[model samples]
Target chain A: MNSHHRWLLDQLPQWERDGLLTPEAVRTLRERHAVDDSQPGVAQIVMGALGALLIGTGLIAVIGFNWDDFSRPVRLLFAFLPLLVAQLFSFRTLQRGDASPAWVRETAALLQALTGGACIALVSQIYNLGGEWPDFLFWWMLLSLPLVWVLRSSSVAIFYLVCIAIWSVDRIERGAPWHGSPMIYPLLLLGLLPFWPGWPPKRKLSVSVRWAMTLSAIVGLCSAAIFASERGSNFFGYNEHSFFWLWTLTGAALALFPLNQAAIMEPTRRKPQVVLGCLWLLGYGIAMTFRDTTRYIMEGSSFAMHLPWCWGLLALLVVFAVVALIQKRWAVLAISSLALLPLAASPLVKAEGGYYNSTLSWFATLQLAGIGITLIVLEFAGKKGAPRLGAALLSGLLIARMADSHFSLLAKGIAFIAVGVAFLAFNILMSRLRRSKQLPAS
Target chain B: MKSLPILVFALAALAQWAAPLSQIWTHEQVLAKGTLVRLKCRAPDPYDPLRGRFLAVWPEQTDAPVPDGAKIDRGSQVFFTLTPGADGLSTITSISTTPPGTGIWLRARAGYVYDKKVNIEWPFERFYINEKLAPEADKWFAQNIRGDQGIVAEVRVLNGRAVLADLSLDGKSFREILKERVK
Candidate 1:
């Protein structure tokens, strides 16, 4: 008899006695619930480990071997070697179905990531690429993108997004011509939308994978775009052509709202997608109007005082606040503040450069303050759930920015130590909170 | 599943083709003394510091007259042919505004032409000039009082009048420089 069937039978003695299951039925149940006796042999485990070791060793050897070679063809072959091997292994595994699917997939993913890194390194080696490291990075990302769907590997997707972020920043920093194109980073995130919908709630692996992909995508895209845009041209002084391209790309990404609905299998996931979709749409609308409204307000036009774009941005914020209130998602609420935060200080500083009274400095200060407050609040309100480390890291970022502005290396060092201390304190407090919660409640 | 191998093959082919496009050449092949290499100029990257990323090329051969001032129409196109000068450096000789085929072309001050050549400098040797310094030499040639359009070439003379070297915008041989950096 199957062990599970036997246990069930033992627990239901009364039912059995009352003829709920005859001898024949019990036999049928045992047959139906029988566990497969096949077990993975020690040899298989050793082989799997050996395969992983070989893959890693091969990667290092290839990189080390070709470090000095200037031949593009040779570099290209080395870059694709791991991927080719991985594909072969995957094909064999799929054909035989002998290996654990999970392990095979994981190993394939690792190979994909290695291949991606090698591709970037090889391209960089080939290009003698100086200023535009990001452009080559974008190509690396595009090449690796197929692995995300083909291998169903979230780790590969996240790595790809990271590369894209680096590329975007590089492009913006170097002022390469990336004006009218769809921001590739955001499009890459769309791949993760599939996980947020079905089956993930029941599967911890899928949920964690989805979360990593989504978080990386959102943070990386926003940071890259902001860094690039701010560094490339003055925030407000960008030409209309540039602004139009930015808005168009953002709008197109937002227009992918229908796909979000396709993935909605549960109410918990569905609600957030709906809200995020609306916010994205509204955000783009506001971004479109931001320039014209700013111009109008600067010109002292009374009619432009209540520009529709400003209202749209404000309305989006209110919606975000309301959703956060309803869903009890404090993280979302905190992030929503970023939208209004830029506008709050714009009035205090002039458009052109000013030493102390500049809008940028004030904005930076407020950003520090906001992050600091959010950290404290998160720490105090939900001691165990507090995002203390994140807050501390953000505070550190702000301090660094301030130090950089003034060219104060000492200040930067001090700020880093302070942030580290804050992170430690938060972590310690959270541990204590968890221990106390675990104690018997009186 | 059936098409997978084909797709892989196509990708492999494309990668092979695209890989060379990113490289910059570094060898002195075809760029020896007195080569009438065409220079192609690129506008300054908006993000770079003023004149920092701007590439100015004076074709070793040109058919148009040089402008008195550095300013040229924002979007004017002019052609020049490279000439090997006595200084061993290749200098641009501006051709008349008459188009190569038609004589009715508009006469405008010729702008700089930027060209890519494999730069090779021997180890422990300082024969190769810095790219920044190269522009200064080109500028001096542009402003020389001897002619309204052309300037003296010294490098071409020094190297012995090499033939006209071909210019490639598609990054070819760039990998060689990258390999050198890796070393």
Candidate 2:
């Protein structure tokens, strides 16, 4: 039996003992994994990627050794030689066709990607092209593009995303006028969007695992859009509130809209966009709850806030909100409360860069708390652990505020004890109710 | 149809080889047929993540008065036409926003004007060399470069592109010094 099947079988008895699975359920699970035994699992692909990673790191180290003692011709020969070997490996995969194992595809693609980069770096050294790092990464990303598409290599696709995201940030950091991050990053992202692995949206995948994958992708994408240029032209773009609003809107868009709009047939499907969008929205919401963080939004800046700033992104958010409203996604409707979040802070600050006394952050905190409660009521229906996540969001805000609050030491200590006691009481109540439901009809 | 994957792979492989080969070719062409100019320079050792170890070579003089009525912003690419100075090393004859139609000129990035002086960021500022030899090269450079035994960067300028073909100190090529240091 395959490892996944063996592990599933091993867990069946424990699941039965815990009443998490009936005999019928255990039998079905066994039969399901039995059929899936032929398929290569994540283990194989991870091992292949790990092998590629070691070899790639070693390749770069060897190239970084700078074999400059050799004549230019000899060094040039060395440059293409490894690349040729990597290409031959890829050719072996192509000969086997698409039915070739995942490991073969991942190793070949990743190996070729690294070798191509090493070759470029080697040639740059040979010619003494002491130019920018961003340019080198850009070229390397470009050269690896074919590998991702031709091999349908998911590992390389992710690798490409990370490199390009980094390239975008690095390119933006260069501070050239008419810099490309605002326009070009999205274009490059469009190039990789077609290759985004669709497994996360599949029905069979566990929810938490799918959420993890979605969040990983969102992290990759957000790293690229660092908003360095937001300090320039347009309204709040120059204001300190820019990144706050920008990320809030980004999260709302991802949370409300189908991330992969093309594959979004089931309106209720929990995709990366929605999973991470809520997280992004809430993540920033938590940051805004900090009195010091929110105080800087309208404080210290002498310039008066203007109307209709960040219009493009604002328009996109509005369209997504409308789409959600039409679809009756009430959980997303809770996000409308965030529109008032920054305003809640507007009156809380003392003038001129003071970092304290945003008393009204509670209003903003309340908005997020409302959203968290709504998520518990709506999205977590019969779902395990997610309700705790929603509760944690609200409870987390309460703790953060208490840490900054002016409550008496005695009061704070008593509140902590009360929360701990309440948690224990709540868990006992829940377990009792669950046990009652499982009791026989006496 | 059966050979399609191979055909595509061949194209990608050819492009990968072509990118580096083309870079090497263009640099070689500049060295071969371009006008040879020596520039007074000094080197400080630094390493690049990808390009490995090299000396960060700064030419002794890289500024000129902005041409009348020329506004150069920081990060703008400015081209400078070269003329041999009193030390027999290339110095800036004039700065222009556009490439020179003829004669030996090289492009460098501009820094903000300080007292009407335009600071140029030279493209060939990195002279990549063997990693182990860089420390000794920096040492030799520090000891010998400031005085009459200045480090002279041998450069070749073709059109507006320039390449640092070699470096020498007091009539001896840098390679010879590195060789002797190794021995």
Could you give candidate 1's per-residue lDDT for residues A122-158 as a string of tens digits? 4333322233335545655566555544444445555
Candidate number of the best DockQ: 2
Q: Provide backbone clash counts, one per model.
A: 40, 0
Q: Output the number of the lDDT-best candidate.
A: 2
DockQ of 2: 0.55
* DockQ scores of all models, one per candidate: 0.06, 0.55
User: Where is the poorest 10-residue window by lDDT in model 1 chain A?
Assistant: A296-305
| Candidate 1's DockQ | 0.06
> Which of the CAPRI classes, incorrect, acceptable, medium or high, describes model 1?
incorrect
Candidate 2 residue lDDT tens string, B115-170: 77798888887888787787787778778866876888898888777888888887
